[model samples]
Target: MDLDALVARRRLGWERLRVLSRQRHLDGAQADELLDGYQRVATDLSTVRSAAPDPSLVTHLSGLLAGARLRSAGTRTFSWDMVGRFFVEDFPAALYRLRWWWILTALANVVVGLALGVWLYHHPVVENTLLSSVEVQQLVQTDFESYYSEHAASSFATLVWINNAWVAAQCIVFGVLGLPVIYVLWQNISNVAVIGSLMHQHGRADVFWGMLSPHGLLELTAIFVAAGVGLRLFWSWVAPGPRTRLSSLAHEGRTAAGVSLGLVVVLLISGLIEAFVTPSPLPTWARVGIGVLALLLFLVYVFTLGRSAVRRGITGDVDESLEAHVAPTAG
Candidate 1:
């Protein structure tokens, strides 16, 4: 029965199972079973991982590339499309779950910010704190007319073009740890609350629009996305749905990471707008148009790019020569 190989496979499966189980949506029985398997095989998988020949990661990637090539040629071999679909199914669901918790945290921050802003507005210590940071000083003290009128369109385009991708990347990359995600979520929510309070005090809601909507919102969302990626990892460990806690966390570890790629693009777009457009002389209506367009593109890419990977194809393995993704925690 090739017991050694069978055991190796089971060990690897348990590792994957540990990650998927972190979702916190699984039945008690399944969770217990997965947890047991994860513990039993973890040591063995460690050995397999360390002792295995160069770990053959390339082989897995190669197989997928080969499948893509075959599909391009319309060959009648095994259905490899499922591989991509499987990944999209899991990644998006994880992202959705992470966002939910972030929303809840954000709501709490909003209340705190409103309370603080009201207090500060009445007391008049707000601008002083901002002066502590040169960046904040620049943002707060500058006249809206000079800033927005100078080069609004170019600023808007650059900001959205660069920072949106940055947000996505951070959410994907640093999310492995719980703290990074928490920090990101907290920072964004707090800033919004603080800014809202200040604007109310100054009777400058309209003015705030020029500085904020131009690039701040998009840049902020990118940061949140970065945090979301980390939160996904954190949640997998803390909650673990239908599997054991450890098993659910393990599954998340195996996924491909692209948070850095997204981060670079996001910075370019958002940074440029923050530097140039928000302070420019563009009309309110013009700013609105740019923000709207940038947001729509983000939605379209997220919902559409992976549809081919998610919505089409069988839910299982396709052909030989290609190794199937090892199943989660087996007996």
Candidate 2:
């Protein structure tokens, strides 16, 4: 009821809280004092809001309370420093560490795609069974080429990015199953093989490569990385080595999450190339060159920066400070 008297009574406590809240470090006594001050001031503010509801007083106390609350509980504010470390250290390190998994995956997919493409090309009967003559003709003549240019570049890029990101996410999320990741890769590679064979059958091999190469190189690599990371996650638990299975899975799971985020950007670049560079009138060489450059830069970033980070003991997992403490185990 008596707002001014209450303010007079609680002013020192509020001021102490303000000072404590702004402090960079506090000893145990000061921490206790800060907590005590915060509770008293909160009560003061509540009483004022209900009895007097003085605008200025309420505003001042509210601000003080907010700061003290944040100070006491601590807040994880955004930091460009964390972001920089993530890209420069965490992401590349994870990519580098898991390079074998994805490299093998990419190689296997390529072998499958090329093998199936060759098989289908040599076997005209198989293509006929998959698609009627009319459908195959339509696909080779217009549908395949038009697919890239039919939508506006920006909208198409967005759609491609979203779709590819979802696929990458799925690979990481379903990695534990192992079989699902393989199934996804098989489905993706088979479709590409079928299309490539059909395009080659129609004597549009040049056109097919020209349209797909500009984006497919990086796009498919990102997918392979995701699939590899997923398989690694599954294997972590299956064969945890010295660590407990749960511990192994958690470590890999965190790394997998980071890889998933990094792949979003990777896929975005590929989507841009697919929507803009692929359909553009630039010579096929120039477009493919850009795609090659992008892929090379990514590889260099992983092998160079990522390898260095790994050497420095970064595993793409959260910082040790953020990780939960685990029981010590003998090697």
Which candidate's lDDT is highest? 2
lDDT digits (tens) for residues 148-199 of candidate 2: 9999999999999999999899899999989999999998899999999999
Model 1, range 200-316, lDDT digits (tens) per residue? 555676877656776665565556555545566677778888867766655554432433344455556666766665655678767756766665665454555434334543211
- Measured against the true structure, the TM-scores of the candidates, in listed sequence, are 0.52, 0.79
lDDT of 1: 0.52
TM-score of 2: 0.79
Tell me the whole-model lDDT of each prediction, alpha carbons only.
0.52, 0.91
Candidate 2's C-alpha lDDT? 0.91
Q: Please identify model 2 stretches exceeding 4 Å from their true place.
A: 1-73, 327-331
